[model samples]
Target: MLPLSDASVLVRRGDVPSTVLDDDLVMLDPLTGQYFSLNPVAAALWARLERPVPVGTLIAGLLEAYDGDPAIIAGETRAALTRLVDLGLLLVQPEQAE
Candidate 1:
């Protein structure tokens, strides 16, 4: 399953229609026709959308980018990921053998 912090996806609008801008690490939902920007950390996480990463890994990445307490970063990352799930931007992946 995708980590809670790595749950959200980024999307943007297109001339023809909404499309998943994977190259740009963004996705556009046709229904909303709105653009969403993924923060640097989120953008990095989004780049690995195809692969499901663990919560600890995501937090570690963020911790590298921002100097702060690991616990606080972990909590915030989880909350951000949860918000993305609520927005229908992220999907939970079924666990698989590594």
Candidate 2:
């Protein structure tokens, strides 16, 4: 598994197709014939993932759009994105080390 940080770029898996109904996202991985759903917050993140997005961008957006502690938002987003990556619903582009 890859470590996802603020600099990591996240994008929806190209081979996977997704459907959105309200705030929920249903992802179907055709390769494995598996499907998964994301809740409202995760769904919103998924929508933004139509293109590659930096993890920091996501954290900043959530912080400004919602009322929550910054630390908590970052942690939760990282965890959720990790799971999505593991499930093959999302892809991660690791940040280049300086």
Candidate 3:
């Protein structure tokens, strides 16, 4: 995954009600009352968002989890992240000054 600006992601502890089912992450957002099922790839991405992980880090973690080619994973992750961002599931945090 390409590096995403920190200002583009927002996730909170209470935003999702998540459970692991058959090694998959199923999450429900109470605020939006939306239920989501995450595939292994998506689950890995979601897990990383528990904290403010860089998009590149998230992609690397997924590569480790699935042992797949980085290019394919990166493309897929970018699309998924975009969708999540558009869905308002994430709150963008402003980039911290170096």
Instruction: Report the C-alpha displacement of residue 82, candidate 1, in angstroms.
Output: 0.9
Note the clash tally of each candidate.
Answer: 3, 0, 1
* Candidate 1 structure quality by residue, lDDT tens digits, 1-98: 34443333333112322234644445555456756666666666555444556656666677888888888888877776666666666565544455
Q: Could you tell me every candidate's TM-score relative to the true structure?
A: 0.56, 0.85, 0.73
Candidate 2: Cα lDDT at 93: 73
When sorted by lDDT, best at the front, the candidate numbers are: 2, 3, 1
Q: Which ten residues in a row have the lowest lDDT in candidate 1?
A: 10-19
RMSD of each: 6.6, 1.8, 3.4
What is residue 30's positional error in candidate 2, in angstroms?
0.5
Q: How far is candidate 1 from the true structure (C-alpha RMSD, Å)?
A: 6.6
As for TM-score, the candidate ahead, 2 or 3, is 2
- After superposing candidate 1, which stretches have Cα over 4 Å from the reference? 1-27, 96-98
Q: Which has the better lDDT: candidate 1, or candidate 3? A: 3
Which should have the higher TM-score, number 1 or number 3? Answer: 3
lDDT, candidate 3, equals 0.70
Model 2 misplaced stretches (Cα beyond 4 Å): 21-23, 94-98
Pairs in clash, predicted candidate 2:
none
